[model samples]
Target: MIHGILNLPRNIWLIGLISLCNDSASEMLYPVIPLYLSSVLMAGPRALGIIEGIAEATASLLKLFSGVIMDRTRTAKPWIILGYSLAGFGRPLIALAGSWGWLLLIRFADRVGKGLRTSPRDALLASCAAPNQRGLAFGLHRAMDNAGAVIGPLLAFALLSREVPLAHIFLWAIVPALICLALSLKIRESAPAASAPKRVAFDWRLGDMPLVFKRYLVVVALFTLGNSSNMFLLLRAKEVGMPSEYVPLLWAAVSAVAMIFSIPLSALSDRVGRITVLVCGYTAYAIFYFGISATEKNTGALFLLFGLYGLFMGATEGVEKALVVDLVAEDRRGTAFGWFNLTTGLFLLPASVLFGFLYQGISPTCAFLFSGCCAIAAALLLIFFVANRRP
Candidate 1:
């Protein structure tokens, strides 16, 4: 198993390295963004909700457009390069925001880069590997991403502990972001066959996609309705008696857990079945959210629960992308991934806002319990409606 994964195609490793650099730059801000909003800008949960929802929705909508174009062009490297450049440029600008509104605009720009790159990059990875090896390929990518997530938070924690200005730390995210952009230029896309026909029309409908792919999109949309933003999870730690100082470290811890498990669990899905692994991952989300909903001021339990959530993330993230590849024709992968990201992000548009409302209007417990219910519903849908469709 180890030897096989270690020997994945060169493109996969290069792309994963790019992901690692970008994710490291992004995660550096993840641990600080909410805190900056709440503590520095005097924003509330509602504002945070609005920002996350709108930003994610914008990204999702663009992913669809970007993917469709990438497929039509039969070229991936340019989109990938532009996407990284935009994100690298946009990230540091967030440090200049004096209000949540400013933050939203800058953040939207950053997500634009994310939306632009994601589908094309995933498609590129799919193209680089064999059908049966996709799980390991995607897993390696996600593991690298999570490894960066680990690094980002630790760097943030270290800087904050040393009394660095928050703005300076935000500025620092640009370093890895720029590195990612530079490295992306190294990826080479082969020329299309001379006999290939030029695409004349844009395709927005999934009318010709497999029934399984379509149903799986519905399941993802349903599940995403409950999967609130990670900001809420961090906020929950603060609410449950964890000191503010440790939250970044906690973020690092969860990423560490995810990085450790992502490759193995995703590779496992290749043999056992994608649906089987997805069901378990969703089930873990249900359990974790319910546990979080019921727990009081117990930091210990939250850490344990967070660890479980990380394990669940490892089980699902790469495997889900691999499953999408499994469901579609090789030629249609970029568009399929776009639709997949679009469905989930579109639903998440509302889900994050609703969670914020529940957290503020009723109780945090109510919000989490609602998320748990959605997870359960999604898991059941996976079990009954979606086929495993292993390659």
Candidate 2:
């Protein structure tokens, strides 16, 4: 099995490994951040919203520029290296933060690294994989990604349960980050072939993207508008009376399900079609969110909802990236992915903030209901408007 993975292209496995390490590092920190803010820092829902909004907003603003810069320079490896290193260094800062403001700065720095690397890294992965196996490539990457998510949080649970300090957990994450950096250095760059022009004008425009890409972006934007921050999900679980100690276990369960399903769902998308898998995933999300809204304080119900949410994530996230590559030309994939991230991420701020307000003003259930409605609308739009248009 190890050799089989090794037989895959160096770039493919390397990207997977990098994702594994980075996500492990991230998962170790993310689930606890909101809890820490509320419990330790005395922040309210509004402050959590602001921190997430600012972090994602910073990431959104940088993606397009990062993609254009990577394309123009005909260099992806250096940026990838820098991005990962920056994110790795930034992770520890959260543990050291004295206030929500400091935590926001750390989150912003980390997201900046994500914005810089994501498009170029995805383009490189696409370039590395055989066209027929792009789904598998992305799926394997996501599986490995969530594998880290599983390990990181479980580790957090173990350490915290053993009376290990949060600062120690944060500092320890640097180990994986360093591993990722070392692995990244060994992965060969898959930059697009440079033409005789030496440098090309940065003429990539959001308006100039293909119609299919644009339509898909619209669908994603709509879905994301409802797909508020995961913090809300944790908060919902808490509201439903899940013990604070059990929250990480709940997250671990979600990651475990996502890890198991991602590769199979991605492979299924490869065999069937991406749209079929994505539409199904979106419909599942609609139902899952609706369930979250309608249900009361039942651990069984919350577990089931989280499991379903994981399935939806497994089916959609990596498969969506593969579809983006399929719809765009090889040479322009970096720009395409950048624009996609930019559009979706820019919407995340408003989504999270609005949901936070709804949760505070009306009820948590109301926020989830709103999200469910948006998802259902997006699913319907995709089914009616965009499903049959691909060719």
Best by lDDT: 1
Q: What TM-scores do the predictions have? A: 0.97, 0.94
What does candidate 1's lDDT look like per residue over 1-391, in tens digits?
7898888888898999998888888888898998899988999888988999999999998898888877788888988999889988789988899999999999899989989999999999998888878888989999999999999888888888888888888889778977887899889877877876555455556786888899899899999999978899998888888777678888888898989999999889889988889899999989999998888889889889999888888999999999999898876888898999999889988999999999999999999999999999999988888865423
Model 2 CA lDDT for position 99? 89
Q: Clashes in each model (backbone N, CA, C under 3 Å)?
A: 0, 0
lDDT, model 2, position 51: 87
Model 2 clash number: 0
Model 2 ranges with Cα > 4 A deviation: 1-7, 190-205
Candidate 2 lDDT, tens digit per residue, 1-391?
2343345687888888898999888887777777788877789888888889878977876887777775566567887888899998889877788889998899999999988888888888887887778888888889999998888888777877787766677888788888989988987764455452344455545555678788888988999899888988887788788877677778888888889888889878888999889888988888898898888889999999999999998998889999998887666777788888888888999998998999998988798889988888888877777777885
Model 1 TM-score (2 dp): 0.97
RMSD of 1: 1.6
Model 1, total clashes? 0
Worst 10 residues of 2 by lDDT: 191-200
lDDT of 2: 0.83
